[model samples]
Each structure stands twice: as structure tokens, then as C-alpha cells.
Target: MAKVIIYPTTSLILADLVDRMGHKALVAPEAVRDRVTNPEIKSPPLNITPEEPKKGLKYAAVDVPSGIRGRMALIGPLIEEADAGIILDDPGVLTGCAGCNRTNELVRLLIKTKGIPVLDLKYPRDDTEARGFVARIKAFLEGLK
Candidate 1:
């Protein structure tokens, strides 16, 4: 099954759709869970290792903000590992938000340039549009080998 990175990295609906389509959803909670549950990581609450920022350097410059670097550290690897992606633009408040514009832009750029099949869609404003949104996603997922 394809490993699909759903943008916003926090959209449960997209993740659920990917999962239901027989593909793996690479989302933030799973990434954080890996770090938090790792025996090698002694840090709690913050759940970040010193090397986390360093790993992020592969994606962002040293001059970038630590927050962006830290976030990239968690998300960069996911982008690299993604076999496909789904991005929803201008998402509604209840949908999901990356909370960092720089990181969001960087993530979108990374996913788009990843040389994988990516479904880029705009957030639906009405029920009809929502159905079309889901249908498009379903078709995309089903098209993946």
C-alpha cells in the first residue's frame, strides 16, 4: 500500500480516508507518538532530542527559526518517505491547520517536488462540493498501485 502524506499533517478526515482506501496515512500524531514512545528518547513532555533540530537542518537552513527547524525535523522525514500525498488548500477551521505558515509552505513545496502522485484540492464550502472532494480523493487513492 502507498504511504500517503496528508497535508496539514493533522487532518483526521484525510487520514481516515487514506486509511480506508488501503493506504497508510503519514500524519503528525503518529510521528510524535514514535518519538514519545521511543526508549532512546529520555526527554518527556517536550519529547524532542537534541539531534531533532540537527535532522531538520537537512530541510531548512541554520538561519531559520528553531521552531521551523524543529517542525521540519519531524515532518521532513515523512515527506521523504511518502509515496503519495493529498493537500487541502484554504482549509476550514475545523479541518486542520499547520499553525506555521513557513512550515506549511515548505511542506507543500516538498510534497509537490517529491516525484510522487499528489492530489491537490481546495477545501469544499458546501455539502455537494464535499462529496466531490471525497470522490476525487477516493479516485486518486484507488488509482495508486
Candidate 2:
């Protein structure tokens, strides 16, 4: 089965779709679920762990912005390891904390460099667009197998 990277890694719909198509969906944030939710931490809002400089160095050794590095830590591995990808490019809806312009651009670049088949689609605004979005994704996933 192909390993597919899904952008907005938190999207339930995309993840389900990828699985339904018999492909393994790699959603980066899910990798760190334990860190984001801890029942012991009573305050529900503060989900993030403090950034470590050593971890940031993985994406860029010198002069790397912490935000990009943090994003890379979650996503870089998935992008590098993906056999295929689906990008839901939506600036309107809050995709997640990974919506930073520079970080989004960097992720796209990394996916491109991986030279894997990618299905890039904008987030649907209407029923017609939504249908097309689903169709396109289905087509892409099917093509992978």
C-alpha cells in the first residue's frame, strides 16, 4: 500500500478518505498526539510543549526560524517518507497552526523535492467544489495503486 501524506494533517475527512482507498495516510500532528493532549494537564488550552533549540536544528542547523523548525519536526519526516501526497490549499479556513505562509511554502517545496505524485487541491467553498475535490482525491489515490 502507498503511504500518502495529507496536508492539514488534522483533517478527519482526508485521513478517512486515504484509508478507505487502501493507502496509509500519514498525518504529522497525529504523531504527537500524546504531547498535545494530556489528561494530567488540567488546562486544556496549553497543549504545546516548549520548543527546544536542539530539535529545531534538525530542519536547519544555522539561523533557522523556530516556527519553521517546529513545523518541520512534525511534518518533515512525513513529507520525506511519503509515496504520494494530497494538499488542501485553503487560506480561508483555519487549516491549523501549520498555516503560516513561509512554513506552508516550505512544506510544499519539500513535497515537491520528494518527487512523489501529489494531488494539490484548494479547499472547497461550495457543493460543486466539494464534489470535485472528493472526485479528484479519489482519482489520485486510485492512481497510486
Candidate 3:
């Protein structure tokens, strides 16, 4: 099974779709779950502790833009662990959070750099589109397997 990274990482639709297609979703919500709710662990970018601010800077320490380092801290690991991806680019969703654009871009870039098979798609607006979306995703996952 491929470990696919689903962007907007909190997207339940993509997560469910990935699972239904028989793949592992390295979603942000699942990855950061313990860190966010568990008091012992400090979440970065999302819920940074005093010490985590400087952490994970190396991921974005290069010629990339600033402010993204913190966001990368959370995403970098998941991307590193992923073998494939499915991105739902829905402009109607306001393009996700503010910094997410940069983070998402970086994730896609990294996925490309890693030479993984990534399926990029627009969020379905209707039942037909939704069915097409599922078919496309299933095809992608099957190809990986």
C-alpha cells in the first residue's frame, strides 16, 4: 500500500477516499493528533510551545520564504514519510489557510523531488464530479499497488 499525503491535511473527504481505495493516508490531523492534544508534547505552527519555535526550521531554512519554517515543521516529516499523494485543489474552499498555500506548494515540490506518483485534482462540485474524483483516485492508488 502507498502512503499518500492528502493536502489540507485535515480534509476528511480525501482521507476517507484514500482509505476506501486501500491506501494509507499520512494526514496532518492524524499525524499531529497526539502532539496537539497531549499536553506532554508541544505542537509546532499549530500550537507551538516556547521551545518548538526554533525547531523544524531546517526544513525551510534554505532559499525558501520566511514564516514557512514553522509550518514545515509539522508537514516535513509527513512528506518525508509519504510514498504518494492526492491533492484536492478547490479554489472555492478559499485556497485553504493563509500559510497553507506555501506549505502545500512545498509539499508538492518535495513530492515531485522524491519522484513519487501524485494525483492532483479539483474538489468535486457535483455527484458526477465526485464519482469521477473517486474513480481517478482509485485508479491512482491501484497503479501504486
Candidate 4:
């Protein structure tokens, strides 16, 4: 299993798509920003959406007071100190957002997402002709188990 935060939309889909795609998604904080954004950082490999979350996928949101002090200041460390990270070719599809727009945040998050024991899946966004892209994630996740 890999450790990382995903966006609300992405987080929700990730809930099910996670291990299903093949990775032990260590249930982390879903605290809107931390929960989702944090994982997004490390797991650059996940698929993210800017408009709305994918259906059937479920995720939690973290509720930390605005200002760096109340939030990441605490959780950020935990993520940094994590054992491993997950990254895919894409962050997923975009749907919607209440606070930050998916496109805007995704840009920053994409660059920010990185760490050790990375289960980075350098899969292509295209290729209906390929299956390894999906399998790579699954294989990585399975390794954890």
C-alpha cells in the first residue's frame, strides 16, 4: 500500500479506485486540504479531476482552521515522514471544487507531489491499446501486501 493525499474529487474516486487499481491506500486524513492535497503531493501517479469527483468513489475531508498553524503544520510532517509515496502518470479527471478549483490546485499539487518508496507509475494518459498502465499501479500496491 502507498501513502498520499488526494483532492476531494480525486479522493472520493480514490476511495474505491485505490486498491482496485492496485495499491494499499493507507486511509489518511480526508481533511479537505490535508487529507486530499497531502496524498496528491506524494501520489502524483493518481488520476485527479478539476470539475468533480468520480462516482462510486468515496473519500473523507479534513477540517482544519485556515492559516498554516492549524493544519499542514501538523500533518505535513507526518506525510514527510511517511514510509512511501505513490505517483501515477495523471491525477485523474476534473469535476468540481468548493474552495480551490481543480485545475489551479492540480497544477501546484502535481509539482509538489513527491517522496520516497515512490510507487510511481509513469503510465501514459492515452493508450486504450495498453493495459500495463493500470497493471503497474496494481502491481505496486500488491507489493505492499
Candidate 5:
């Protein structure tokens, strides 16, 4: 099965769809869960180990904001591991929000440059559009197979 990275990594709906389509959805929660559950990361609330920032630097430069670096630490590896990707552009907060515009842009750029099949879609505003959105995603996932 393809390892598909879903942009906005926060979107459960997209992740569910990808899972149902028989592909792996690379989302942020899974990454965060790894860190949170790891015994080595003793920092609660923050959940980030000291080495996390250094890991992030492999994806983002030193000049980038620490917040972006922190996020990229978790997400960058997913992007690297992705065999495909699905990105929902201009999504509302409820739909999906990565919480950092620069990170969002950087993630999108990385995914696009990965030379993998990527389906970039806009957020659906109505029932008809939602249907089409699912249809397109289904088709994309099917193609990956």
C-alpha cells in the first residue's frame, strides 16, 4: 500500500478516507503520539525532546522560526516517506489547520517537489462539491494502486 501524506495532517476525514482506500495516511497525530509516548522524552506538555529541534533542521533551515522547525521535525520525515500525497487547499479551521502558514507553505512545497503523485484539491463548500471531492480522492487513491 502507498504511504500517502495528507497535508494539514490534522484532517481526520482525509486520513480516514486514505485508510479506507487501503493506503497509509501519514498524519501529525501519529507522529506526536510517538514522541509523547516515548519514554525518552520526559518533557510533558511540551512533548518535545531536546533532539527534536535538531531533527527538524534537516528539513527547515536554522533561520526558520522554532515553531516551524518543531512542526517540521515531525512532518518532514513523513513527507520524505510519502509515496503519494493529498492536499486540501484553503480549508477552514474545522476542515484542517496546520497552525503555521509558513510551515503549511513549506510542507506543500516539499510534497510537490517529491516527484510523487499528488492530488491538490480545494476545500468543498457544498454537498455537491463534497461528493466531487471524495470522488476525486477515491480516484487518486485508486490510481496509486
Candidate 6:
């Protein structure tokens, strides 16, 4: 079975979907806040934070949802080391997505498994968009097999 890692919101939607399909969808224990911004990122929120830098370097990891953080930081790496990795996370920065984001705070660090692939889901958070998102994920899983 392919190891599917999804965003927290997406993870809730697909919780039963993965089980019904007999694939393991790991909803892990870490939070979205854990995917904190590294000091190197020169962007706002991450960059604008008032945290002091330690010799020009600041460790700004924060607490996020348990769903996406554990997968990106823990499960994704594990899958890569043994089996192939299939990461499923929302590409959008909005929608109150409680997980690792495009600024790639955590994904950049752990996604080293060569065969692993990270699929950024595209949709409008509407019915049609949701269907399209599922369809895209199905296609992605098919490609892995």
C-alpha cells in the first residue's frame, strides 16, 4: 500500500477515504505550528516576526495541526527511507490550512526520498473543486502504482 500524507483539513476529509480504499493515511501527532519558518526565509509573518536571531540565525518553529506536521516531518521521511513517499498537502496558503505551506518550512528538510512525490492539491474549497481535488489525488496514486 502507498503511504499517503495529506494536509490536516484534507486529512479529515480523506480519513475514511483512505481506510475505505485500504491505503494507510497517516494522521500524525505533530501540529501545524511545528512547521515554523527558518531564519533564511526573507518573507513576512515568517520574516516579520519579532523573534531575535541567534548570531543572525533564529529557530522559529511553531505549533501546527497534528495532521500535516507529523507526516511531513516524520512519516514522509520514513516512507522515503523504506518505501516511496507520496505527500498530499494543500498548495494554498489561505483557507485556514493548518499545515506546512509553500514557503516549505518542513517539506524542504524531510523530503529527500528520491522516488517520493509531493502533490499540491488545487481547488476552490467548493463542491466542484473538491471533486477535482479527489480526482487529482486518484490520478497521483495511480501513477505511483
Model number with the top lDDT: 5
* Candidate 3 wrongly placed segments (more than 4 Å): 42-47, 50-53, 62-67, 94-99
- To one decimal, what is the Cα RMSD in angstroms of model 1 from the true structure? 1.2
Pitting candidate 1 against candidate 4, the one with the higher TM-score is: 1
* TM-score ranking, high to low: 5, 1, 3, 2, 6, 4
Candidate 6 colliding pairs = 30-66, 31-64, 31-65, 32-64, 32-65, 33-62, 33-63, 33-64, 34-62, 34-64
The predicted structure with the larger lDDT, 1 or 3, is 1
Better of 1 and 5 by lDDT: 5
lDDT: which is higher, 2 or 6?
2
TM-score of each: 0.94, 0.78, 0.79, 0.41, 0.95, 0.46
Off by over 4 Å in 1: none
Residue-level lDDT of model 6, residues 20-139, one tens digit each, is 555666444332223344456455443422222221121123444443433444334333443333344444544324344632445433543344576664544789987887776667
C-alpha lDDT of all candidate models, in order: 0.89, 0.75, 0.72, 0.40, 0.90, 0.46
Itemize residue pairs with steric clashes in candidate 3: none
Question: Between 1 and 3, whose TM-score is larger?
Answer: 1
Pick the TM-score winner: 5
Cα deviation of 42 in candidate 1 (Å)?
A: 2.8
Tens digit of lDDT per residue, candidate 3, span 1-145? 8899877676777788788878898877665575777666545435655444356565676565555666676677888899988777664454343245777777667766777788889878899998998899888888986
Candidate 1 vs candidate 4: the lDDT winner is 1
Q: Clash number for every model?
A: 0, 0, 0, 35, 0, 10
Runs in model 2 lying further than 4 Å from the true structure? 34-53, 97-99
Candidate 6, 101: how far from true, in Å? Answer: 7.5
Native-referenced Cα lDDT, model 5: 0.90
RMSD of 6: 10.2
**Best-first order by lDDT:** 5, 1, 2, 3, 6, 4
